[model samples]
Target: MAQLLAEKRDFDFVMWEQFNNEKFLENEKYEAFNKKTCDMILTEARKIAIKEMLPTMAEGDKVGLKFEDGVVTTPECFKPVFDLLKEGEWGNLGVPEVMGGQGAPSFVASAVSEYFMAGRSALSSYVSMGSGAAAMIQLYGTEEQKKKYVKRMVSAEWGGTMLLTEPNAGSDVGALETSAVKNPDGTYSITGNKIFITCGEHDLCSNIIHPVLARIEGAPAGTKGISIFIVPKYFVNDDGSLGDRNDIWCTGIEHKHGIVASATCSMAMGAKGTCIGYLLGNENEGMKIMFNMMNGARMHTGLQGLAYASGAYQLALNYARERVQMRELGQPHDAPPVTIIKHPDVRRNLLWMKSYVNGMRSFYQYMDYQEELSKIADTEEERALADGIFELLTPIIKSYLANRGYEVCVQAVQVFGGAGYTKDYLAEQYMRDCKIASIYEGTCGIQAMDLLGRKMGMQGGKVFMTFLAAIQNTIDEAKGLTELADLGERTQKMLNKLGEVAAHLGKNAMSPQYKTAFAHSLPYLDVMGDTIMAWMNLWRAVTATQKLAAKPKGKDLPFYEGQIKTAEFFIRTVVPTSMGRMDTILDMCSAAIDISDEAFGGL
Candidate 1:
């Protein structure tokens, strides 16, 4: 099997052709970068992924993590890979140079992360949490906080974790019981037990910084009263050196189904009443401050979905091309057995994986571009639109991409038959690892609610309408192209149905029949995801059509035409079924709401 993380040609096409990443060069923020420089950086990232990081995948999975006496140790083989990520500065790809980073654009950083994550998501978790912690400090922490933590986290001299989920508080963060008491020195003495803390306690770094969510004494009872605190494993001196250990300990690590090398810990703070935690933001503003990090984490989780799916698809593709099983459906019984790639059903599954993988890539890149636009838009209106659309799509991008990415992983396993189910192959591991992406961060159901309940009505629905109009515009563009006209019509019809369903559900959600409407939220989200994918594929096809029309002399004819074909397959084969789901949502049947508790009988 070819060691694949991502297809470079596809990456180039998306960056140079579809997205025009060159546009960033026009902005002063990116004045130091150009096409060659960006490409070279990506090339180096790829080398690091394939050569250095890839070797740790199986070792980490097989050896997993060891928890003993409150310390978590990852696979011995991973120690070198962890160091490589820090020394090569892969963890600081998007941070500003002033903060000791490479200052890459979001899209470029996303691309690099896809490769690194595809290499070893478990190890990548340590880097991700550290970088996320640094970003939060950079955005909201006081100057002293930034000076103390940001550079160290970005430099990977220390790692970090977001300690929000407690034993009693997972999805309902408002129900947390952790308490923070103010001490004489103006710092808080944090006391709490947080569960599901990824990289909570690891030997890879000398120190770990925790952004803990706890209720300050006399604060309100719910999420409104929560505050964020930065509690480091080792206290820092006034002159920037390590001091005595803080009152935090890792009780134990979970033996997870996969990504086992990443320590998922149960952490206890202030066990000895000495956990010195400095306030991250103002009291009672923790959720607001945490959003700055949660939003980014959601996006990165979406990328994990894409990365794992890509990993499975890559391995499956290689296996299919080499593993012969039976003759083609139409071939003679006496004929030689062909590779599974020649089988019709195998081909169908491959195309399914390819289409969704392609859509996910485009979706993530577009989201990253929007994030950049929110920062660098030429006008206030442009910035507002970028921010609104980004807010609207974050849930869908996170949940929808994860759902489909996992589906792709399942299909990859199917492509490999028995081998895919066995430990000899990585497909099962991919499935196991990707499963958490949908569950944590926010479950698909939670995301669906966010999409329908909040995003749909955002800014009196201007964002929703604007997004729909853009899809319509693309549909109109593709409708004029002779070869793509049919797929364009299919996509347009899905858009109209989706628009209607969104209005129906959004309106009903406010009425007395909210449960009935909410019951269908996940289904509605699926329909929206399908429509968005149709939009992405159709847009890609339109780009390919126009490019082929202008540059007919290119040797890359097949690749361009494949784009059109992929769009065609998705429109004809995928979008139609999603439209049926739209019909189901429009029906608004009350069976789920009306059914008695006993109907969901004994397990």
Candidate 2:
């Protein structure tokens, strides 16, 4: 409601300074895009979001989807918003030009995603899911498959969905019971029910293409037998025109906690014995192909977390500045009532919210730049390093941002006081919408296990060592500034402790003692994420310090001062809190695994 997109400074800073768009513009593929063009795209996207999407967001939440007679119907207000997005071609921003797309760089697209996501989380889900599905098709589809689907999908003429989750298989995708039988004509017949499928069924587009994972008859068990397929709601003809409706229908929709505008449908495939699907890649290699999309989706989900946090903060900030309340200490009782923003505690919460959102934006953008580089790096070794770093940071970006972003949203509600708890305000909705981010895209616990168990040990630990070296470089650079120098000392000590933890986990991973060490894995992830963020923010402050020293005194001065102050606040407040968390982790005092299931049966 407070227009979070207009107040976004962190994204601009990352794009212009940290990510360095000039480097991308020089590429032959991105030669048409410059600063002016990027600005125009962002401006247009914001206009569409405010005019078309934001207005429907509240209405969608108020009048959620209704299920009747085996069909799911969305809020009536969602139609116009979906139409505007389709007309604007915003869904095709990063798609290749050969497929009738704008072919923008990933960094630019990431920025656009943040703006849209901040405006309305539910509407953005439709676009992101479609784009993610299109990316998968573009990457692995055969030439004929690409010609049949890519153009329409890129233009948003066709919507897309990923059908991986089932009632029995959520995070353990390998446990899926969906079956695919090869027909004589080469197309496979798919049969299964998929639950919690977002954008699975909607009248917003002419067709819906689903990337489904199923197992072939008599195939090897577990993940080894899994295969990816493209199943459309309607079969496409050789001439690329719609042909016949396939045997896929929405059986019902979930009564979700939030994101009510996007339909989370329960789908039945091959109930009538005619669901046709085409394999995307080689048999038994489906998991490998799907990871391409899952990894991207995980990152985009992190962006959604940041978006909700920023939106909540923006609303709270506006309320704080406008709503009058009781007087602070040292003020005259007769003095006019002042806004809550005048109070130090409220200001502290708002600053914490701001710093966390800003740090996440910068960190996420850096990861996007790494992904783009992985695609275009000239040398194999450089590409390999980029790939490894991207892999290592993905779990952190997803787990840390989702966990902290939700906390920041809670703080934002606190800033709003009583009004925040009521449905009359949007803060409560933001909290509900953001809560799922941690549970989906693999839970925070799963991400921690991935980080500690696999990523840190990949390629004989070279990637972890590289990341440590980067953190060390930040420390070395910060040594010249006294305030940051002290902060760097503490961060380095935490980094040392993390290294020790990694070593201990590596040595005893096979024994039953590993479970004891595993209990602290999540805390290790939190400490690692905070350490990385502090390192990045300090680097930014160092840059701001240099710029401030050379600038003329004016309005520009406050911007630099804000940057410096935020860095100091984060180091003093946040870093020390992370130290305490690390101590608890080292203490290994939690009873999480030791307790019996019956102890919690009261629920």
Candidate 3:
């Protein structure tokens, strides 16, 4: 119940010290917000998150969602909390002011997201869907569409969603059965059944705007033929008032594991033969338009992962500090019992969780800063470089944080022992909620394939090499410290060896042995993720080392000292196992690919 969603001290450390976020304000776009303004915003956000949203997490889970009479009803507790978020305009914090947002930098927005998401991840879907859908319209819609939708959506007066997933075509989106036909009017008649649509039928807003994907009749097959359409629950008139209800129907909602308060609906369009929709962009450019939302959602999903992990870790750490257990090792049995935090293995687990939570948090901040930099870069080359790094790290952030987040949940539960497994605690719920992060957007395996199959070869691998060089630069800077020099040298060696493995796998992906290359892609992705984690840890250490050298007084001393210890722990303890795993990947084993279907068993 005591959820300190995110650590404020560390947040400011990374924002001000590691990232130097004030530099972002030089661009007039963000000049309205200085350090004091950003810090105040963060403070206000924390207050709202704890005061309004934190209480809704359990209520939503207990009451859950209802889909009786073909109408999805959310928890009673959610309405007021959602109203607060809407009133505060937190739904679209990072967008430019012209688009009716606070115009906060992506890095600052990430901090707010961490706070809000940690309270109740299920409800955060409403905010994500609203922003994602509105962004699509703002970027690709006509002036009329923008005027009608963007402000309302950003203000949370209207709810929105991405309607891509279907029953027959889950990840293979090209195989969708939805069809679109041009009508006599400018709008088109959309006929499709979309499943797993989040925020598809929420009652928090007056109208739910759905960005649906369907194929135009007689268009090309596969993703190319797909087109995006604006299928609203109720039509909007030219004057911006709500029109007659469209043919959109929420036939049912899924009874899922976690985030039970959020509706995952089976949406029926044109079931009554009256679903009217307007084309978002040019025909057959649906994938192109949708990628913007997809990529952004992937990054948001990474934030959710970190939120879950951070909350769980905090809970575990608190429990460990309070729970009395056996005496310290090497002490007599008659000695006073020590807290579980003093237990060696428990300490190991807490440190492991801490290292990842800190690394992932810093990585999120860094990734967001890069995104903001890309938007405001002075030089074409700098923008392009940031763009490439963003692309390369997007999948990593989503999959790596998700997988690691879930692991952190498991450890948290272990720290709490039996209570963590019971309903009395929060660890189980965090694990259940975190599972969707990796599975959604794309599964871990899919992300792994995307990394090796697409991003590695993109722009002749220049983008990925740029990413490598960024890591190398961090290593180069950290290599100067007498204490951390050894870590720097070892990390460089591991990364250089990783490049070797990447080259070997890259060649194999093009060669006749491609199946084997793809088979080991997951392991290769793990290697890359850990290497980046090492980079983030080392990056933190470099700043911490400089601060400690200054002999900071009071709380600043411990904060800086802890950053160095976290970096040291992750680099020396966690990364060695990761490096050893990469050595195995370098060997290019074919056992997974060579084994026949019968050998896999239970076919």
Candidate 4:
């Protein structure tokens, strides 16, 4: 089971060496965390994850969730683990101390999260969704609202979720029909039904607070009139004690293909005309507030990709090392069959998995570092740079990592062959659970549109240009090193071509042929994702080259060398395909849009 989680040495390399954890500790915002303390935190989290949580992963998936009337019963094994997480306060690791959380740095919290999430994503969502809600309340809630909800939410005493999707408004929030009417007091009465609400009605917490999106009576139409309200499962009194039950009820839970332990609910609010809710930010600003939380929520969604993919790759690697079935290509026919790891094809697959897993981990940590910098930077300029880059990378990290991460999981299944498809192994589960990452938190299509439509045009393209420039810096530094010169040159060429592609896409998106540009937006995002992966691999190579100069001995030698080799494998093996993909994009073929629907034979 331990072998199924992230490689600790690689995790340390990204945290301590690649991104430099020490620099984050220099900021007073993170003064409470030193390397030792962070290590202890990670160690404790790993223990809880491996020993207490990992055992429940398959058990939870098999047992799934139970719905009796309006109540949801999670997997029997999840209760103890959930209790342990809440008791240890692991859920609030990244929240600030002032806000009743442990105040760990973003990087450390992310490492801790990788362990827990890899152990069991469904169980972790309970806390994560609540923390997300608490963060919103902390940022936008009135003092009374914060006083009523934040601390309890931080402790997971009460659960939290965002209720936006209705039967009519899956992706389009403006079309939602949930309504709110002003009450005698400042509170409003909420009436609506919501679908796909995660952790919406679980038995884990005493109460569930919902940040529901509803338009007030007499408000204007469309999203401009939408307002957000804090509606709890059970009302809270003036003293913060649980009060009468609210009008919200869980109608049903979805039987999903994966993450079965999580209760994706059909929630009906104000059936009795008594659902009392307090306004969150202000009237007619719900979408704006929700968009603010979307980045974090989307990043959280992105983590699912890394979690499932890492665990799947680890499982595949372990299986290869143990499963003996193949002989080397040149070995005698009568010779002993070696472990699958000795097979060249299997080795290539493992390296393919290794390279992506390694790159994804580094890229995730890099994004976390940007978040830390944005918060801790002294100068406004530094903060802006961090903010700009973080925003620009958001869609890429969310969409690319998710889509690639799913592919990695699929590849892991392929590596395991027939055994992978059975319930006996967790590879299939990883693939199943990971499929949702690309579909949820807005689909990959939505992410592609956001990247091309909004993010590309941010600050008149300065943010996008800055991101490319940052990647170029790594390429330039790697070019100076003899060991990495060729790898860096190839990556630099890809980066240059990517810039041109971006320019072409940007122009087409604004031109009369916008439909053609939108048709290929997803492919454009794919190449961008590939380019970012290459950049991450090159960065790892530079770090490994610098470390090799120190003459590390024993296991460290292979580990450092592996980083360079992984970079070479990706740049040499995979990036040429990305270059070809870029060519197809430049061709700007309109077959997708030009084809008439009636011309298809399927009908």
Backbone-clash count (model 4): 0
TM-score per candidate: 0.98, 0.95, 0.98, 0.99
- Model 4 residue 504 CA deviation (Å) reads 0.3
Clashing pairs in 3: none
Instruction: Name the best candidate (by lDDT).
Output: 4
Which tens-of-lDDT digit does each residue in 1-603 have in candidate 1? 265878777888888888887888788888778888889888988888888887778778999888889888889988888898888888998988877787889988999999998888888988878888888888888999999888889988899899999878888999999999998889999988999998999999988999999999999998999999999999988798999999999998888887888899999998976788999879999999888889888998899899989988998999999999988888889999989999888888898888999888988998988888888988998899989999999998889878888889999999989888898887888888888889888798999999988888888999989889989998999989898888888888898888889889988999999999999999988888888888988888998898898766654698889899899889989988898888898899999999999988995
Give lDDT per model, in order: 0.88, 0.82, 0.88, 0.90
- In candidate 3, position 316 carries an lDDT of 93
Question: Which residue pairs in model 2 clash with each other?
Answer: none
Question: Candidate 1: which pairs clash?
Answer: none
| Deviation of model 2 at 552, angstroms | 4.9
lDDT per residue for candidate 4 within 1-603, as digits (tens), equals 337588778878999998887987987777788999988888888888889988899999999988998999988898888898999899999988867998998888888888888899889999788888898899999998999999999889899999999999987889999999998888999988999999999999999999999999989988999999999999898999899898999999999999889889999988866888899998999998887778888888888899889999999999988888957789999888988989889999999988889888899999998998898888998899899889888988888889889999999998888999998898999899999999888999989998899989888998898889999999999999998999999998999999999999999999998999999899999999898899999999999999999999998999999999999999999999999999998999998888999886689
The root-mean-square deviation over C-alpha atoms between each candidate and the true structure, in angstroms, is 1.3, 2.1, 1.3, 1.1
- Error (Å) of candidate 1 at residue 497 is 0.7
The clash count for each model shown is: 0, 0, 0, 0
